[model samples]
Target: MNLKDTAARAAILGTLHKAIGDELKAAKRELGEGLRAAKQETGTQKISVSLDEGQDIGTASLVQPKAEAAVTDAEKFTAWVIENFKSEVERKFVTSVKPGFQKKLLDQITAAGVAEWADPETGVIHDVPGVEMQGRAAYTRMTVPDAGKQAIAQAWQSGALAHVVLPELTAGGAE
Candidate 1:
């Protein structure tokens, strides 16, 4: 009700929120493994778990795995792209080609995330130089129906929480 009390409550709630988030990640990992195993054994790609059978709840489903790529060396990648794929490079010169713009290696690599980069002329698949690809396993994706989301929002908006916005706390205590 008071400033000090609200600050204390918010501090405690913040800690609890972080702990809950860590636990949720671990739980999700376990659930994803189970989902993957089930899909493998049943030869099914689409697997979902109902949050609650009798209640209107969210559902968690196993989605396809994706790959992640990151450019570790920007200069090396830029040189490689210029030598290998000239068309992918963008040149911006003010006076001459001496101080021209750098290649868009990061942009091109990011746009080509989780996909193969092929040579334009040769049509041969080539790995982007200085870019390392990491394969991410299929993870469980959770989805809440629109109706459930609306109900949850309404409930929260109508509750005591509506007026309990966390204020900017001072270093040692409430201002």
Candidate 2:
């Protein structure tokens, strides 16, 4: 295709991709409601559905109230970690304490679940300093067939989208 045609196609595809994304988001929201209803009807926190029974086209699973830990106040949390867990400090960060503590705390929090941890020296469980639980939602995660994976990879390797310089669109055709 010529440059003009390619650029036009890129613009159209961009718009279409965005529309498809919005539709997917709406569909997922509706599907989440349906998943919640299925959970309520079945009385199970974990639910799975197979779209094409024998063909294995797609699958979605839900784990209700999934909690992830997020660090809210890094400075206060780093100070708390340094004061409480001195030995767990990593020295490579910034020739100082805050960054190291933050990295260590993040690693520990990820190992433990949802802002929780065990004192390495004492063995008592406690919440990691400066962290809070976020995203405790009953969202369904999907897995679909990799039917276009090869084609997509080939397109990338072929640089099919490398030089798609789209012209700037102006409001009201202002030059």
**Deviation in Å, model 1, residue 93 alpha carbon:** 18
lDDT of 2 by residue, 2-117 (tens): 99999999897787666556656766887778778877899654433332123334566666654566778766666666767676455574423456556665667765666877
For model 1, what is the alpha-carbon lDDT of residue 13?
81
Question: Who wins the TM-score comparison?
Answer: 2
Pick the lDDT winner: 2
Q: Given candidate 2, what's the lDDT at residue 16?
A: 60
Off by over 4 Å in 2: 1-4, 44-55, 64-99, 102-135, 147-175
lDDT of each: 0.59, 0.61
Misplaced by over 4 Å in model 1 are 45-53, 65-136, 150-175
Candidate 1 residue pairs that clash: none
CA lDDT, candidate 1, residue 74: 66
lDDT of 1 by residue, 4-103 (tens): 9999999988876765566567677878788788888985545433322244546678887555566566676667767765765666752111222222
